[model samples]
Target: MPNLPDPLPWPEAVAPDTTAFARQAILNLNRTIFGFELFDRSLAQGTHTSASDAALLFNVLSHAECEVLMQRKIIFINCTHDTLASGHLELVPPERVVLELPPLDAPQRDDVETHLMALTDIRRRGFRLAFDQSVLTEPHLSWRPLASFIKIDISHASESELSAWVQMARQNPKARLIAEKVETEAQFAMAQDLGFTLFQGYWFAKPILLSGKTVRPAQAAIIQLINLVRQQASTAQIEDVLKRDPTLSFNLLRFINSAGFGLKHEITSFRHAVMMLGLKKLFRWAALLLTTSQGAGTSPAVANLAVVRGRLMELLAADSLTPEECDNAFVVGVFSMLDTLLGMPLAQAIEAIALPDTVVDALLHKQGLLAPYLELTVACENADDAMFAKASATLKLSSQQVNWAHLQALSWTETLVD
Candidate 1:
């Protein structure tokens, strides 16, 4: 992979939005597992967005906060070889920060040893170290003495790999084992069975609408009504559809009367609100429902993930695409995983709704320009280097653009969800 450029000049203001970061942390962990460790990016000065700088900021800030909360537990933060060489550890109080060494590309033994030795010094000063995304088998274990924790990416681990991790965890009683990407109940169970204590992933809280199942039938009805309204059907025709679904009609009237529509007069019936809202506003609301309903039951984390992905993708394509095209890309990113979130198939979930041509194409077929962006988003979520590289190349996007998009997406998701 190509090296990403130094932090492109920070905008006039770094939006004081930490919500996306918090949300990603929550979604990544699924349930509220105490001691939330996050990658802090606020310290990157000027034009350089150094991974090392991010790691150091996380260690300093999160560690202090965790200690203040009376949690003596270690908060995991990623550190690169460059940051380690900079003696960033000297600035951080070691007892609380768990400096997680990210997987290096070349797998150099000498470099690894040198980094481990530096970590050992930090550990002796009361800091803990961990190996993140453990991919190298027994060879990586040589640095175990310097690590207080080991994070295994159980998502890609095979039976033998899992067994190896379990054996290693059991043998090293002093080190706590963490299982990353524990997305499903099965994964969680396996991690627990394997003696891993820390866990992360989206299984605990699914992305859902605020109303959840209560809104499903209404949502389906609303989509149908919107489709009819968009067709320029007569008021009576729309009314006829509304009359058939009294509950939906009643809810529509209620929604219109509520603060959402700032109407002084109480809308007594669905037809009245429909007429008052007009076709354009009605269509807009209906489209908003697709997003609102989808976000209902999701934890702050899951909601943030979708939001960031959508916004980042939109931002990336803003300069190249038309407004409509950009909007389609955003929709694709937001609705990409609706099936997994709703516990329904994607086709089934989007069946009744009418989306844009590009949105529909990307969602249903994963083809078109937006599809590659969506794929890149998923690849980032999985941290699949090969897939990420492939998607970036296919999209003709630079590595720097990819990283910026990922970070911005994560940040945006956190804010929107919150």
Candidate 2:
């Protein structure tokens, strides 16, 4: 073969990873999520750089948690003039994300018109624009017509000031109003009354545990199947349980037939699927049912996190544990977030499903063979350097191994969630 040119070399160290700590400001209107505003959460006390914004986009859209957290929803991202020109915006799909730009100083006054011209070019390329309420004031007035959304900080604005802003927003019917830092019922109601289209801040995410809602039959049936798999029940025995729930059986067959399984032929019977998938995969599917099966008030956020943790823990357990123990590790990871999903205590939520004593101990008290795996998985998520070091040392794992597993889990979630 003829000599070929070498590919471009990879960077020495990964970028600072600012996106790992970014939290989503999930915006809502009338109980439905409108979009997510990803804010950088650097523990360091200083101003953010252009790199921070770039890292945020990469995490949300490129390689991090975007696919799961941003499923079919609009995303609001903070963009300074520096970030806008950094060329990272071109990497994302403009249709799904709204670029929230901050106010730029009109140093030469002509720069204002110049900046708008640049923004107009971006808008032509399919990206929508968002501006703060300050854009309603003097120098930004010329920029206001270009805004698709206007964010008002309700925390500091006076009553009359909010009224004026609201009036200004009404004048621009094309602009959607968003109220941020809304903390209480009064603020939420006031924002609603004032015609703000989207609301954000503490009040929106206040967890309301669902104690009144009963578990759906299909969900309960899935739980039964998971327990049966754990008990090492025969395929015939499990088939009888699935027979009672046609909906659950149909879902299993459909899932096996879907692209997720990569099967050559569609599975028409539960037994055939069990035999095709075998026990290991059958249990894996059962475990996924907890996350994917629709029910009342199950938080996709919790489900997605659980899936990542479960897969990471299972990967870490490779070569060190039995096949069955590895399966338990997966169970511990995915079900660990049950408390957040069910809106109850972990004990109560886990009680609804039957799991091994080892898995239960890991979930309940963090004391078992699988407990360290769960702890390490969580430490990975929180970026706790000390815990990660300690957990890896205890498990005889290296940072490189954990990082590789973490990336693999994120990739799997991207395919599974969307």
Candidate 3:
């Protein structure tokens, strides 16, 4: 791992009141998880300085547990020229991470040459580089060859313009084209036809509603198990529910033995696992099972996002809310995606499960005491700066706290593998 600078240059007082990083998935043509593009939601346009870029890098590479998760897939991070030259860039393994170099706002010939030198050095050190469509301009031609990925914002270009960019990007044999901000099925199809190899945006997370769709039986069983655990049912009763659904029993046992649990010995029986986990932990585990149930048409990314949201909400509310309210906060986070997961309206999907009013209010109506925490959790995932700042102010949480908790939640979700 590369070491950060001895004394980081970013000043404490100049930092924004809210600094939160959100990741947008970079998917392959098949719509599978390829990598994540991490960016700061609180940063306003044209405000990405060396200080802000370095802060983002520090937050990512600082966590030891996250290193394992990060190693599993490619990570795309936006970089300024200054960050490219920063020592922390040396700490990140070049193969696992792609440094996205943005175009200069006002291109000067001398400045462009200097920036190219920096890009060359970084690439020579084994780091892959990505550029946005601005690289298609004549002034950026010198930087094009170094690109390993080329991102084209589909929302900003017409078909002909996008085609031209795709053609230009293909001149670099090593570059893989990414269609950015693809929000609809049509955009996805057009990009696919344009020979784009990767995609990023909300299109994949959108719900495809069916008039008569409801929860699958296996999912309903998991919900039932969750409710039984929440009610603190007798061990025999819990075991009975598990016995009726072998799939749920297998999932429970598998979860207990997973690396996240850190259990030394495997407990084969449902009753044994129940006794070991107890009510509180078991209820949480069952809720996870419900989200991860093999529902048709649900993206794996959606399930993963739900878990991250739940954990983030719980952590953010830990210091302020009562223990029970904090637990409700977690529920609000996890079930926030119920509508998409179930392929129905959120209200309709939430009806299948039993929850406290606090959880229901936040999930369905975005009201109640836990609503602010939910807002903050979703704000961390969105690019809306005002929403993030407003939520932070409403909760009186600082940027450092929210940023730390968000990374912790991501690390926690990485521990739970199917």
Best by TM-score: 3
* Inter-residue clash pairs, candidate 2: none
Best-to-worst lDDT order: 3, 2, 1
Q: Tens digit of lDDT per residue, candidate 1, span 165-186?
A: 6686655567777777666767
Rate residue 60 of model 3 by lDDT.
69
Weakest 10 consecutive residues of candidate 1 by summed lDDT: 18-27
Better of 1 and 2 by lDDT: 2
Error of 1 at 94 (Å): 6.5
Question: Best to worst by TM-score, what's the order?
Answer: 3, 2, 1
* 10 residues in a row with least lDDT, candidate 2: 1-10
Query: What tens-digit string does per-residue lDDT give for candidate 2 at 1-418?
Result: 1111222222234344434442334555544667777655442443566777776677567644347556787888777777767787777889988888888665645577778877887888888899988789877788888888998999877778898999987777898988987766678778888888787765443333445555567767877887787788999989988899998787677777876556677779889978887777777887877655535544455466677778778778875999789889988898877655555666777787768889999988999899889888877765455676678789997554565566566556646723
Instruction: Give me the candidate number with maximum lDDT.
Output: 3
Predicted structure 1: lDDT: 0.59
With candidate 2 superimposed using the best TM-score fit, by how many Å does residue 214's alpha carbon deviate from the native?
2.2
1-418, model 3: which lDDT tens digit per residue?
0111121222353345445587777788656689988877656664887777766666566556458546677888887788877676766567777888878877365588788988999899998999988887878899989999999999867899999889888999889999998887689889999999999887665444445786787888888887887677899999999999888888778777776566678789888999988898788777877776636755688788888888889888888889888888888888888777877787788786778988988887878899999888877776556778889999998767777677677777876767
Give the Cα lDDT of each candidate.
0.59, 0.71, 0.78
RMSD of every prediction? 8.9, 7.4, 5.4
